[model samples]
Target: MEDDNISDTDRALGFTIPARHARGRIVRLGPVLDTILAAHAYPPAIEALLAEALTLAALIGSTLKDAGGQLTLQAQTDGGVVKLLVCDYKGGELRGYVDFDAERLAAGPEQPSLFALFGAGYLAITFDQAATRERYQGIVPLDGDTLAQAAQNYFVQSEQIPTLVKLGIARRADGSHVAGGLFLQHLPEGEEGRERLHTRLDHPEWEHVAILGGTMGIDELADPVLSLETLIWRLFNEEDEVRLLSEVAMTRGCRCSPEYIAQVLGKFPVEEQRAMAGDDGMITVDCAFCAQKFPVAVTNVVL
Candidate 1:
């Protein structure tokens, strides 16, 4: 189900601290995270990286001006255990996958550094507007200790908006995974336009907000019991006022189906399609994000 308002655990929300010239988003993923991660049976390190990517997607994607727009976070590397990582979000739906060298990962330390996992990689955040068909993307090197730190650098270095992010991942006693994140940005006091030319390098209000966000612990963030609203109030309770936004529910949204698979297979050359068919004369396609297989009969594919 999408946007189910009954539960608060698997949802993301945006809020603003007008008094401090700042805005932020927080997300806590429960069963949705478990479902997507369990489908692939990835290694623990890969799972943690993917979880952070998903959390960043949701935290940033929720800010899309057009509800129909899509936000994609991609990381590519060379000469590393992890080769590529991708995650996308649209209308409160998220799906992500990671490609890594299993043998190399097994030989590495139990908890590898970002450099160990991705020797030389870059992180890209792209937004595809729904109505305008316009695409905006920011690319930055994987330079920080954690993905969250890299994201903060993304906004500061690429977008030039001072930002901070705290991402957390945890496993329950039952061995189920969960993730959460916080994204805060300083909107300097200036003109009411997309480009606020008057952004200060050392804004006092932004520092106050960032310091508060930095105080949050990973355990506190990944805790399933804390509501999103509570997390916000906990940080800004002493402030003059804080406005809460409506929550957007999330799920393991994988855009894959048999009909769609058949349509794609119909595009391939008939000879190539037939050559790829299995013993049953069917071309089987597996969706990487969902780990679901779709078999289309060669006879039905006419390209």
Candidate 2:
């Protein structure tokens, strides 16, 4: 059944299948994704990849332990489609961008797979918690065919947690974008008991749920009319029980502001700052995340 309580777009629903001893999260990104991608006119392939990255970031961010913290997912590659794709999630806000070779992308193969687009690359995930001074990061080789598969590999290889991830992205006739993802993880039983158990391999329940998840098609996942609750029920209703834990709202937001840009420019030498000024005697700074432009006056800046 669909949950009438939550809004239609940019939301995540966390659930647990106690009978299977597994936890999962489903996310729908509509207007938020459209707004983020609309900020820049990227090629169709680049836009799709960015949407996938944003969806993955939200899925991982919703599972963070820290309330006041940020999760950053970055993909660095030496390929024709994209060089760098970064997405950051903080609170309920998400933003991302991509750097690619335009000429190469235009001349490359049509609809290249993730591995082909990011040939021999790495995916890095960083966690920055406000309560702690230390930042944690994990790196994994991008060996999967899709970003979602790579994420699954990360949890299994780096975190040693059995996980399955699926992501879907689509473009509407109006040129807007929509993205959604499903994440399932087997929670650790206990540290003491885990060591005693020896190996934390995949369970039969994990395989069962993963097979059910694979039945979902990209159209169903990315459909704006499909409510997350309905989708979850459709996927796991046959199970003994599926419980909805909580819901989180997501938005399209950037951490860029005039003061922040001014502070960054202030670090440069006076001559360098002057050289950055335009003919109008104002230094213009463009934010890569939101594509917002900030024009700063020389006299107004304190350097």
Candidate 3:
């Protein structure tokens, strides 16, 4: 299979081929990206970047189907609350956040470059399996300026697999957000298949494919006039036998629970917990991802 026509909408609409007889690929994303980023109050640049990262993260989680697996993409800066985390669970639930210095948003976008915003950081992928399997983690330095390039680098270095990620973010006129992305990877198989696919991907025509794939903007995606199905056909309508696997949808969900928070509170020293709990006899825990606040009474917390 030629690795030339890889695009987000193409796969979002459904692109399928056998991994053995052909290279299997799927790339789909849209409103779900907006849903994840819309829950937060983020600056324009930061919002755009994180949305792109979240799109890729969700796609990865969906594609890598492991009932007990979860993937988290975190980018932490040196001295800012600008930390970004997007977590994906095995069941296709996705949640994301942009932690920032309160004053930073007021100071404006000029304060931090993407690198400085997330200084000296790294990208990590954690995998968990069934039967209480040991978790595996792979971490790599953030060598690229953009998250797309950084993630692509991670696959190249860690898995010895060549891949390409294209992400685009746009601001809507009514203050909404939209994002879309594509991931093209050279699958590990026979040397002949790998070499042929790599050559096509590196071709100049492939650049045109990449360029055109990113032009679908926020307005087009969010507009009711254009749906994911129409968008995909717009790209690869000419292909006769393009098979779309099951359509996967992504939404924001926080894994935090009252029971989970209670366990966390138990980690602190008894004296500290007592001091914070106060005479009001209650503790409030807000989820970092969804901002869902949970208030628990002192009597409810048990060691």
Better of 1 and 2 by TM-score: 1
Candidate 3 residue spans exceeding 4 A from truth:
1-14, 18-35, 79-86, 104-112, 130-132, 190-242, 263-276
TM-score of 2: 0.89
Give the candidates in order of TM-score, highest first: 1, 2, 3
Question: Which candidate would rank higher by TM-score, 2 or 3?
Answer: 2
Model 2, residue 142: what's the lDDT? 91
Please provide, for model 1 over 108-177, each residue's C-alpha lDDT reduced to its tens digit, 9 standing for 90 to 100.
Answer: 9999999899888898999999999999999999988999988988988877788889998988898987
lDDT of each: 0.86, 0.84, 0.59
Could you tell me which residue pairs clash in candidate 1? none
The best candidate in terms of TM-score = 1
Cα TM-score per model: 0.92, 0.89, 0.72
Clash pairs, candidate 3, are 14-244, 81-99, 81-100
Query: What is the overall TM-score of model 1 with all chains considered together?
Result: 0.92
